[model samples]
Target: MVAMWSYSAGYNVVEVGDDVWDLIEERTLVLFNHQSTSDVPLIMAAFNSRPNLSNNIMWIMDHVFKLTNFGIVSWAHGDFFIHGGKQHREASLLELGSHLQKFYIPRKRKWLVLFPEGGFLKNRKASSQSYAKKNNLPVLENVALPRVGALKVIVDNAAAEQHTDDSDKIKYLLDVTIAYPGGRPLDLPTIFGGWRPACDTIFHYRRYNIEEIPKDEETLTKWLYDRYEEKEAILQEYYDTGIFPDAHTTHDPKFEPVETNRLTGQRVVHDTLEFILRHIFYIVSTWIWMSFLYWVFTSICQLVW
Candidate 1:
């Protein structure tokens, strides 16, 4: 499905390095950088493009999965990674396999996909640095890539747990950057520019992992975060030089403080009105929906009888 969209939409994907996929094929735990929401499907298309990587991508999704129809659709059929409840902190190898097998794991290879940043981050450079520091991983301060905590989880799991004899438990970070030819690189605002609804179909695969940091579980968590602080310093230096631009660095000057009249009195009146309306609307909507459903079900029962 994603491949077909990519083919139709004319989105071009550039592979930053070939070794990235090589690590992938070798059953490495893969961590990808988060840009726009477009990241996921694009990666799916890229994975499909490779003959050897048909069904090895797994992702950890969040709670919006229940509230929206989009969530239902994305994971309805495909093989991906996910965790819920206290299970996430204590997911056993057997439990991981149970979810993993839903997507069809091979007889011996252990492959996984993850986004470590938790969710979309507005300040990628700073957030990535902080997360890296906390996890004892090196930070790519110049550019916001994958967060280290998620990678730590994968590493710790892989290191402590055993897989098949043929399975090699290695870790990798795939840093993907989205770009447009002759156009600006995609960012948070631009991707959702037109009040566009859910990104059902879009083709975009910008950056594949260029750098690889290999570490064992015991030391990886601490080592990864230390890298973030180092990355922050490097980024600060890069910003000073104007050499390569550090992403998410504020450069505009129009941002200035503005003063507003004190609104405590007016705010009190408005809040009172808003409170009344909020309850009225909530009760009204709930009653209407429930009443309509009840009538419909009653009519259906009568017709059946």
Candidate 2:
């Protein structure tokens, strides 16, 4: 993503709010609104300064994503993919809950990332709205109604699961609102071509302590729906103002601006020099891991032959 070497397009994918939120170090359950296939790559670029997250993060994704170009990479990275739609929803969630209970501690996963809307807004919005109409829930314009099944499963089974280490457990839920400037989301080509977004794709964050969040099914589902309501409101305001308003400042709550504790910018890894340095670091690190893999492969081949 550092390919944005041009004078005009070389802008950083900006992180706007909640500057002090410990996104990098702490164990987290992150909610991201799915836009296009490019969101994951955009996240990779966002993690330019926090490269360990790129390696260690666990992504919970739609089962259909298995057919995408990134599928095998996700599988190799150990991301979780569960089937979608009502037919398989219950079974898939039950399976996911079971898997999380068994895997979270042993896998040493620090962050769990998922899209609660179940599908992209473009594909699922109409159905979401219809369901809202039937169920008497709010019909949102920017985001589809989020399905709570997976969220519930993860919260019930994975939230507090942790290694015996004294590290802080999954203590936070990061509600991340990703805005593609001018409603134009990035595509997969950017991974190879670089971050070519004419303007920066801005990220807004709100941190909630897991201890403060509701745990029961009914309350948790209500809390998630309330969050989607806030997400839609944020999106609408972003479209109107060309900026994400700090919820604390915008007649809303928790969306504080990070003037004193900015996360990524000139202080972060956005410069051309950092980009080159990162390239060098990765080039050197590549040999370290690849050499181990090479030895493993050769040893296995010798044993078989």
For model 2, the stretches where C-alpha displacement exceeds 4 angstroms are 1-11, 20-23, 160-168, 190-197, 249-305
TM-score for all models, in order of appearance: 0.49, 0.77
Candidate 2, 1-305: lDDT as tens digits: 33333222443467766663456767788888877766766666666556467566788888877888667878877788899867998899888877766665467777888898887778889999999999999999888888888877777666655535545357678778777776667666664555674556777776666666677889888888888898888888988888666663121244333443544432234456766776788788889889999999999999999
Q: What's the lDDT of the predicted structure labeled candidate 1?
A: 0.45
lDDT of 2: 0.71
**Which number leads on lDDT?**
2
Task: Return the lDDT, model 2, position 182.
Answer: 63
Residues 81-180, candidate 1, lDDT per residue (tens digit)?
3443345634533445444444434343444666555555454667667755797646563345443444654544543345454354443343333333
Instruction: Pick the TM-score winner.
Output: 2
Decoy 1 TM-score against native: 0.49
